[model samples]
Target: MSRRWNPVHPNVTGMLHGGDYNPDQWLDYPHIIDEDFRLMKLASANTFSVNIFGWSAIEPEEGVYRFEWLDSIMDRVAEQGGHIILATPSGARPAWMSEKYPEVLRVEANRVRNLHGVRHNHCFTSPIYRQKTQEMNRKLAERYKEHPALIMWHISNEYGGWCHCDLCQEAFRGWLKNKYDHDLDKLNHAWWTGFWSHRYSSWSQIESPAPHGENQVHGMNLDWQRFVTDQTIDFYQNEIVPLRELTPHIPVTTNFMGNYPHMRPFTGLNYEKFAKHVDVVTWDCYPPWHNDWQSTASLAKDVGFVNDLYRSLKDGQPFLIMECTPSLVNWHEVNKAKRAGMHKLSSIQSIAHGSDSILYFQWRKGRGASEKFHGAVVDHVGHEHTRVFRDVAEVGQVLNQLAPVVGSSMDAKVAIVYDWETDWAIADAQGFGKETKQYAATCQEHYRVFWERGIPVDVITPDKPLDGYKLVIAPMLYMVREGYAAKVESFVHSGGYFVATYATGMVNETDLVNLEGSPGPLKKVLGIWAEEIDTLYPAESRELVMTGGARYEAKDYVELIHLETAEALASFTSDFYKDKPALTVNRLGEGKAFYIASRNETSFQDDLYERLLDELQIGAPFPVQAGKGVSVQVRTDGKTDYVFVMNFTEEQQTVGWPGRSGLANLLTGEHVGEQLELEPYGAVVLSQSRE
Candidate 1:
């Protein structure tokens, strides 16, 4: 199956744009409020998410519900030809509930209950909190079911956090018992609990991983991570099922954090698990705010991967970039401004990948409080005559021209495996180098080669069927859960090329080392077995001498391996492991499986991948003569191809004519010939003739 997704568009008669619009905040200031509509109209925004965090206003006290203010806001948006992504104010517990029912507040890992001032710190497992939010959701759906502006139901704001309180611990024990069939021995053996005499005598003996007592228990930590994720999903399902029954016409969704692999401080959410419950897959994306806006090339690739990953979640359909910034963000250590064209570049990149809509966090900057300084469509200047506003206007104009790409998807023949379990397990196994470095960077290093070559790659999990992808890359995948090794074997044996890098298949799903041999389960399919491993300290380097007379440097770590039924593609030439195989290729059923024993230099990866791709007869999505900081992505309706070429840098660049020449630039309507030049952060969407 190529892809199957049921994408429903509610309240959106056209392309969905706009974002969190808080008219209730300015109910007193009619003059300043009048300008919000004017600015929205200028920006070409059509949707507004209303009443997101108005729980305090919705239900000021127990059993008292208010809706006059929200009713007015809804009617106002309806009159202005805008749709509403009506939100349930469940993300943050109301101050009254937190103060009265203190158990609703989450207890931190340090054993202190969080105060009422913060958002997203609610104990979701609390019955009182659940009852209050249930009533809020029921009332909102009852009132807005007939509202003309109601198109989508936003369940809660970016739901991911954990509560380590006793109540949650009881729930965790219950979860573990149900999963383990109430067999303590099975649970203990799976977690290797007896290694440190930590075996549980009873269900109550199982505790949350956030507590310092079990901080080093890798298996328990992974399970707790999974438990919290399921808890959050269950919470969302409880809210969504009823909303769908009430307002069945409207689609429901919750915003997911795009920094998904690291949203672990709380619920440890895996978007794949949550995607099915929502009508649309949406996430909040913020690239590194550490003042690295020089080119944003690498960050843009991450953006593309996330967008494609979201698209893949619903089986290759369009998703939403629900919350992004038009410019700088306030949460950074030192808030920095996004260079002029960067905002527009980021938005288009999301669209080019697979996003159907672009919505910002807030329409206007907050006047006071923590996020008051955050970037907004309408800045604190009280007017729309600003540089950010102008840049936003340009993006809106471009989006209006992009109605063709509304439901189309980026065509991908390559996929990079992304498993939340592996990602979480790798965090517990972070002593491979001199210091604890994130395994995510190594995963992205593999993604970078294809990204640079304009080759589209989807981020897939082990559960997803690999029927369509010609090539699959799994790097830094340390944990091989049950049945996953079989999945990898099936993909390669079915004539699909596979690549497995260092640290892959070294541990089981339980975070236990494979006692057989390194890459234990996959050793058979991969035809390689590792004897010992060596971690490269900072500044230490090893060389890999390839059979083709090409030499590449391996750094960060090295795995000394001996091949069984595979040929050594390259061998190490350093330390006591001299002449050992560094890279091996095995001829499987009808295809080839390549094993990279260590992290290699970028140039080496690029060179090796180019040869492998050439041998496999795979090519870039499109041919472009653009330089660095330039990227190309292709999407299609299986009839007309949409080609997106973008300049990620702040300097002007030119690209020669593509391989197939009958292309018309969608922006300028110019038939590209010889060369096309783009200004700083310039982007061009072209329609390539399929025939």
Candidate 2:
């Protein structure tokens, strides 16, 4: 059951189709509540998440308890054969609690204690806050452990931010001491504190990085990041102790945040390590679709790459899209509405990767908050006669039609490494020109080539096994941990294709330079020596001239390489390193390893991967040859195949659906022919039974 998409609740089957519902916001308007139930039926949403930020309403006073309102909402959902994802309401503490205990508030990095006005601003290390959260969770579990509507336990909303208070400082020191085996010398060596005489004379001297104090120790910064993540997870584990004890059957999870403003990964905390504590993985996806800087198809590829990353976190298990806006978000610089048919297309795109459900951030928008204008299922108008509401209804209908896609999973033969530790190390590096690092963006660029070709790719961390994948690509892997080089060597020696870009294997886990060479531990496997890395200005670019006479543009970074056992496939055609090897390949055994010594244009990657696709005998998931802006993805339920074909462009696209007869179009309940024509922002789910 864990291999596929496990059901959220036994009573409610099919794709989960509801979102964060805050009935507490409209408690006084009984008519609004009545209309919400009516519209819920119209949208075919069977699940509703309640009490996400309802702490103030649940516990208005320090010791006073109020659950009659929540009880009514739970009973009503059950009466209508729906499910409730009950939240513990720890995302925001009650005003009374904060007023009673000042320690509950977080301390900023500048050592200023916060005045607790916003959500996710509580001290994760505060004993009083932990005690209060456990008490609330226990009370909720005691009341609704056996309730028919109670399905899942949403522990907290978007767990992020860190505290630098005295409590947290003590905890961090303890963590470091434990990691270093209670030896000050080991801590000093690991943190490389001798460089600036910042070595700790006492444990009390070590504190979280600060602007006015200390931030130059890369090792300390890295450890601080790890400590914050551990502390956050430790706190989450504390919140769920009661839920695990009382309602062991209910799955517990907290929604994870995706990339922020400019498609950068959320660097606040490491979700990879935190994902192990939860039963299922879920994330909030809000891509800036149809933006002026990028094409719709390009944006779709980015979303696809991220969805695959989340799906791969659970080993390809069907995860849930906990929160996504139906139209436009109020937080963007320009809140542009979603174009016609895009809502359904984007929703299906999630399912195509490995999502079992497409849920929104809010069921209904609030009236007087910062997010009042944020897109929701029901806007401030309080009716179902809106454009965004109709799009939600349409997505719900499509989810209903493609029920078989639920609990399905994707099997990919390609694996791309996107290690968070490597990213953290790269981000903390003082060199490499801050604007040009773009670690996540580089991985996405490589991933897009495979995505456009409909080649299923698993975005994995550096530690994951590479047993099944034919090709393993690790782009911008600046930090090579212990034994990882041996792992790559063995993988390539055993006839597996390996690809690594520039800036890989430069340093150890402690942020110290690997004296073995520029590529350090990986030099032997990569069959090349990176003598120097040259960072180019934004306006500067070099030409990568292949041996086959194909010229492509290379930019951002260029590595001077001296071959060991590899032969040059491409060379630079400009500057002092003109005609030097820009790309090389080494035949280890039955397979080969390719090293790209510089960053190149997307056109170069597209051409290179297309050739690799044929050489490896890997083809698209579907048999159809799709046109430009058309994306084809596939998922399997172990007995059947579900192919999702979507057109992400503003113009119509066609796909040559060869020899795919008698396949049922699950959305329309019709048989497909040899050719399928898709309109702008259109999508179709084709299901075929296995032999």
Candidate 3:
């Protein structure tokens, strides 16, 4: 039987409503409070993510407690019929705490300690920092455990970044000791420390990877990244244990940054381990409007991928969209306002993924802070007459009409493994590829092809089981972790089709290359051996002629390999490496493994992915060529299916329904038969016809 996601909170109806509400920051508390609640009602907002970044207000002094402000705020919100997702005020530590305990301040990669004023400045390894954070969380959870409005426990604000303080150094040594089992010889072997007279006789000799230091080692810096990720996870688990003890029923989670580079959300910290402690996995997604529409759609699909990551970790639990910018973001220099209807369309896109709730970064504009100019439901103007306000209200009304239609929708079976650790290792590699060739961009390129066709795809880790997916694509996977090759082999042996690209399986988890050969462990499964790597300079290009006589162009980082038993699918067709196998396929056991030796343009990659999908008999949510700029995604809860078709382009596009003759637009409550047309930036939520 397949899995399903259903929220237990009574006030959270079918669809999640409400957003981040910070009434504490507003000066005219009484008037603004009334207006905020009024706006929520007008927008049909139901969930209030409160207490975010309110440490100073809650615990002004070292130990003096003050919950009067929060007390009043929660009481009023509860009275207005709202559910609360209370956040632990750890993101923004108070100025006094930082000034008093300077050790809590985080040291950057350059060894400079940041002063308190800005958020995310606390060191994860700082004892005092953890103590204060835990104390604050304990107090907040104890005080609000039985609060009628309480529904979920949000621990910390978007957990990210790393620390390079003495504490972190000590912690890193301890982590390495455990990982290498205190065997200095193995540690030296893994990091190749003997090359630079860096062999460690004592674990204490190992220091934090600081960019400002003399003789910086990439291997050390790489390990430090992994160590910092583990430290942050430890901090989260520490806080979560106590919070769970207080309110076991309420789910606990910290907001994760989607595709965050620094944290490598998938590995090191082990999202699977983190998921065990977290009840509901939530993430913040804010793709600037200037990014490509296909990229944005791919990001929307990635939300489900993240959810699937958490689900796979926790045995299939639903995830939530904790924070998304409703309007213009303050971070970007030229923050363009989301085009009309684009906001609602994007919000539905999140829901189409496994998002149980959609919440914004802030409900009201900050009066004075780094995020003061950030987008909000109620802008700094303080009235509901603004364009953003009107759009928010319109979205709210649409949610009211479409509440029951798309409350609990699920997606497809195809999963693509996207490993951030592999990305990091690939980026940090010394040789074998061009510096400009990025793993994330390459993986995203492959995933975009499926996303554009409304084919549901999950960005997963290589360690994840591949029982359900028809095809698993792992691009630029440079690091091959322990037992992963065997798992991939097993998946392939079970009639699965796996595709891998160049620069894969070259290194171990420690960032050390496997000296045996290129594509180390994966070579057996691929039935090919990479003899030499051909690095192409900028503007250099090669052509790949498919078996069907279709030719595609390629550039940057081409691998010249010898096919042992694999059949050549495409040849290099350029350079001294001409006539070589640029692409190969090996029939291994009951499955097959395909290898692409170079990076190709979007058209080639898309055609390749589409052909694979066709061979696997994977079906998309909508018909091909329904519209050019319009994208469709389908989610279901067994009984009903909600199809979200969005027009991301500036020009209007028309979409056609082949099987269904008539459907009701959940957003507008309009009836349409067979075919429908959408304006620029328009969106339509179509439910399975009741008739």
Candidate 4:
């Protein structure tokens, strides 16, 4: 009988580990191959991602295929009781192909065509590239579908980066035709091309937006961003369909860069749109780099937020950590190494947020290449005794011991609403003195308050189902889609607490402002009108005195509101709008909607969060106040709870774990009391044993 994994895929072994094993780099000595099998066996690893960047190696000259070497690697892995994640080497076209069809190369905004060197610099619009990629995928599938080692199909590595060649521009026109139904007038209006005489009389009048530079029309910029994202998704769709037809049982997925805005060419990556094409969601986890000048606590928090974001993309289904550094990375200005015990901590962190597999970028370090210095499973010493190697082996052993974690899921009562369209619209806009740089910062501030207070929140798109969540927050929500206001109204009137900060419901889906009034669709539910928006100097601060005797220092953007049905909870104490409502609440049915018109101090936010939870009659799921630096996350196998307690700080600290007084850790089989001490970067999985 064939085995099945959660999210509807096959898994013939215990929780998958290992990644990107490019044995082709070590092909000089057959003994190296034998040694790899020995090391993988010693490490208890069962999965290997192969052919990640093997385009030239697999198809060197013309259509002459050379997968026999790959076949040998696949057989060797299978004989050693391992499975393969077969990757299509389409991320980079072979040098010969790129040399032949320069149209396949990427073109920058200045029209400088990129040379045939780096990966992900391929033109997304090249039909030749797409056709060759699809053919390669089809061949890879047919060749390995029956092989016992083949378990999954990886389409390409990190599928993004924009191109500006004429073919791509022509392809953009075709995509626009489909999007706008070939109506130039509608396109013109939607793009708001009247400004700067950008209106198109014919379909051929348009070109890539970056040439006009950053100061182009805002609506055009937003639409062009959406168009570029669509091009990437279209390429993925074409590649995946062929693979599915060839290997009916195999699941297909491509790794993502986990929504780090500005990493890709544009600021419009709709992760939700890409999630629909794959059987399982896979994302690379390389948190923002920190030098000696900065700290990594924020990095850990970012990982937590993104892990939940990707998990929410699959509707709480477990995803995979497709690429993470074994120790340090090479891209940043200062590449920082993972501290001792962080390997286990990071892996568990991913698993706690619903990742079934934890994999690395490559299995072994290279002798000479662009990424030779990057972290790898086998270091320069080429031995199993390295510190990083021990960590990798220990992680595999721990995963094998915790096999029951497979198929486990997590649920949250709080939801934070975010959208790529909203991000793009705000980023594209310039007239508002209220800046776009602080949009994500505003959301993260609210999320951090909850994180510090031990309140787990699911970062969700606005269109997600709101049936179960008690509190729904849309922070810096500037563009509210059609029917979304009605959805919020219904959710509030039906007893769900709704919280929106400044800039909520200001525009429609088309990046067009709601001329009716500010705070457009949510005005009725929020029961207030944004009379005016103002921004203060960075160092300047204002005061907000709440009804309950707490005073908060407010800063940045402020919306002076004229209330209708809303009752003032907090009033500003400075400026011409002194004593005006800064925070207002409106009661609907048994629920209430609170609108915060300005960013406030951290202490104020903490106090505000507690009051909201109290008013909503909701409490933390577990005793998350287990002291500082401790994170308590819980996941269930539907019936039993497996709680992960981790210490992110450097000093040893004792904290309380949720549930009965004492429980046995599955790893050590030792009974952990309610109060247990975790050393710096230590983590433990406490298994719940029910009566």
Could you say which candidate leads in lDDT? Answer: 2
Query: How does each model score on TM-score?
Result: 0.96, 0.98, 0.93, 0.95
lDDT of 1 by residue, 122-147 (tens): 88788887777777788888888999
Ranking by TM-score: 2, 1, 4, 3
**Candidate 3 lDDT over residue span 1-691, tens digit each:** 1344557465566666668888767635688887887778777777888888888887888899879888987887788877888988888888898889999998987878897778888888888888888888889888998899898888888777888788888899988889888898888887788876878888888887656542345567667777777788889877776788888878778776654421124433445435555777777777665354444444544444555455445444557778888788787646778877778877766666656667887788878867888899888778888888788777777667766643354455676677767766666666744566667667666776877788867667665677777788888888888888888888888888999988888777777777878788888899888876777778787888876678888888888888888999899777777888888999988889999998888888878877888888888855635655567777666656678787766777878876676677787677778877778777788877322
Global lDDT of each model?
0.79, 0.88, 0.75, 0.79
Candidate 2 C-alpha lDDT tens digits along 176-252: 88998989998898888888689888998998999764448999888999999999999999999999999999999
RMSD of 1: 2.2
List candidate 3 stretches off by more than 4 Å: 8-10, 212-216, 259-273, 291-316, 405-411, 432-435, 689-691
Indicate the TM-score of model 3: 0.93
RMSDs, each prediction?
A: 2.2, 1.5, 2.8, 2.8
Query: Which residue pairs does candidate 2 place in steric collision?
Result: none
lDDT of 2 at 425: 88
lDDT of 2 at 310: 84
Deviation in Å, model 1, residue 122 alpha carbon: 0.9
- Which portions of model 4 show Cα errors greater than 4 Å? 1-8, 259-268, 288-295, 432-436, 657-659, 689-691
Give the winner by TM-score: 2
Error of 4 at 523 (Å): 1.2
What clash count does candidate 1 reach? 1
